[model samples]
Target: MSLLVTLAASTEELAPLLMPPLAFAGIAAAIFIALGFVVFSFRDVANRQGQGAGKSSDTHGSGH
Candidate 1:
């Protein structure tokens, strides 16, 4: 039938991926690793501030 022919023609016109399917997973993993490094870099940030590195002690108040 003509309908079967049209369906077969449409199925053949599929789009191609810009990259392989596994490459997409690799890209996402790389992004997460980079973000993990960024977060790790700030690991001791709070401790640095508590050490009187830059902030003045009296900023919170003299009551302590």
Candidate 2:
């Protein structure tokens, strides 16, 4: 019932939760979610600009 025993037991119970594979999986999931957000935002902006259907600006300063 000492402090050391309690801490040790807590750590033992929590050790598997911080293992490397689980940590990597969490990081990968986070990155994928972030990428999805970025892509979604880009598509939204393109749609708002009326360029969502593959149209692009071609009006360069050619002075023709």
| Global Cα RMSD, each model | 3.9, 9.0
lDDT of each: 0.86, 0.71
Residue pairs in steric clash, candidate 2? none
lDDT of 1 at 45: 90
In the range 1-64, model 2's lDDT, one tens digit per residue, is 6998887767444345556787899999999999999887787675567763333444543433
lDDT tens digits by residue: candidate 1, 1-64: 9999898778565699999999999999999999999999999999988888435767766565
* TM-score list, all predictions: 0.64, 0.41
Model 2 compared with the native: what TM-score?
Answer: 0.41
Clashes of 1: 0
Q: Residue 30's C-alpha lDDT in candidate 2?
A: 100
* Lowest lDDT block of 10, candidate 1: 53-62
